[model samples]
Structures are given as C-alpha cells and as structure tokens.
Target: MRVFVCLFLVSVLGCSLAEGKVVSKCDLKKEFNNLPESEWPEGHTMTDNFLAKLICHVEKASEFNTSAVNQLIPKKKEEEEAEQWTLYGLFQLSDHLICSDGATPSPDRICNVTCSALVDDHIEDDISCVLNIARKVIDGGFAVERKREFWRMVKLIFQPDCNNETAGNYFAECKD
Candidate 1:
C-alpha cells in the first residue's frame, strides 16, 4: 500500500513539475540537428543552413519558450467579429491550423493536438508536428494552403536578423 500510494503521488505531481522555459540558442542548434533529413514543402530538403534558419526562426518566434502564445489581432474590421487565431509553443504555431484551444470550434486543426499540449515541456512531439507540416507538398487544398501560410508567417527572409544572409548569426556565440 505504501509503495502504491507513493507511486500515485509521483505520477500525479511529477508532470506538473515540468514547466515552459526559454531555451538557449546553441541548445536549440543542437536540438534542431537531431531532426533526421526529410523532405520539406516546395521540394526543399532539410539542409544544414536550413537548420540554422530554423533555430533563428524559433528564436524570433517564441524566444524558445514552450508556453509562448501569439494572439493574432485582426487588422480588418470584418475580422474583428471572427474568432481570433493564436500562435502556440516554441514555433509560434497557429491555433487556426496547428492547435485548437478546446473552447474554440476549429475546423482546421492540422496538427490535431491541443493548444495546451503544444505549450508543455515535452517538445519532441511539437518538433515532429512541425516537421510533418514541412513535409507536405502543395496540394492545392485548404490544408496545404494553411501549411504554406505557416511557413510564410514564420519565414525569416524579410527579417534583418536571421534572414537568408544572416542566419548564421544565431549560433555565433555558442561553441560545440
């Protein structure tokens, strides 16, 4: 009985101990490399420099926090009455396509994971989910469009810091 009770307490409380955090840039550089070489959308593959861009994008998107949330405020009056979309987790993924807040009616949850789950400490699944998004081809459907939009929204080319020309800057400070 004592052993069982202790196990139950640990099972209940252990997960609660995991919290969101702002991860380090070099740590992310190492983590991004763990993703196996895979096909990305638009016929692109995961090149080495692509990994740097990804780390940089994650840096700008969520500051590496598992709990970051970007509430996308609509600029148009027509969209004011519509449900606001949100970006969740380290990638700043959209609730409109990647997650559902549980309260909102999401007809387009591609990741099919809960928004809360995306904000948790176990991010291997989150990384896999985004990778799955990257692997999708241009299918000419809403799902693929949303996936394209995810890349567009997070694309770093326009950003002066981590754009194509400056992506390597994100890892300049860290040593292997």
Candidate 2:
C-alpha cells in the first residue's frame, strides 16, 4: 500500500510538471488589459479587435502555451536546416529577428532580449518586443498608407486562418 501510494503521488506530480506554463484565457486577458498604451496596438482599431487579433496570433503561434517553441521554416531546402532559427512563446516571436537564443546569437537582436525570456510564463518582455516590432512595421507606413502591405505582414503571421473569415470575442468569452 505504501509503495502504491508513493508511485501514484510521483505520477501525479510528474503530470503536473509536464503540463508546463499554459495560462487560462482570463489570466491572459487580465495581462492584456493591464498593458500600457505603448505596448498595445494603436489607431482607430477597437480594443476588442486588438484583443481578438492577439488571441488569433497566440492561437496560431503557440496555442497559448507560454513555453512553446517552434522551428523556423525557410522557403528553400538549401537555406540551411530548420534548427538555425526558432520561434518562442505565445506570439511566436522569432529568435532570428527579435530575441537571442544565446547559441545562434542574433546580431541585431531587435528586441535586445534573450529568447528564453519570451518563452517563460512572464510575458512582459514578449509584449514589449511585439510592440517594438509593430511600431517598426507601422512606422514604415504599412499600417496606414499601404493597407495591403500592412495586411500582408499581419496576415503573414496568421496566414491560413487570416485567409478565412472567423469572428469571436476571444477575450470577452473569458468573462463571467
């Protein structure tokens, strides 16, 4: 009986550990709501739409898993392997462009952050990096003058699904 109890306890603890840092919708919603103006999307876009788009990106990127990591897929086969660069965290920010993996060492490191920082449960850095990227894109007149170019970039992040028409209150659904 003692051995059986120990085994059961070990299995349960192991399962919990394996589950990793997946945040609930409401929890993520709270984080989004608490963000400053600079860390959020701007212009005439509704706040709800911003939240919805965030959920869409998270869903498409890492399925809301904070610790998720994905390989970068290049167009050409000889462009090196998929292991060279990686995407991390909920937004799937690339190590190549935004963060440094430490090993590969992104020279620009546009975010000036470690990739692991984005992959963890703490999302403050991830949000900041995302905003920086958004600002760079929007600054280039993509979000205003060239609507198609803006959409092309946004759609690039959430490709296949952006091509479809789907609507939902991604954050509101978390409300009581």
Location of the lowest summed lDDT over 10 successive residues in candidate 1: 151-160
lDDT by residue for model 1 over 32-52, one digit each (tens)?
Answer: 666555524545556657677
lDDT at position 114, candidate 2: 85
Q: Which stretches of candidate 2 lie over 4 Å from their true place?
A: 1-20, 41-46, 77-83, 141-159, 162-168
Model 1 clash pairs? none
Candidates in order: C-alpha RMSD to true structure: 6.2, 7.8
- Residue 34 error, candidate 1, Å: 1.8
The CA lDDT of each predicted structure is 0.68, 0.65
* Best model per TM-score: 1
How do all models score by TM-score?
0.69, 0.66
Question: Worst lDDT window (10 residues) for model 2?
Answer: 141-150
Candidate 2 RMSD to the real structure:
7.8
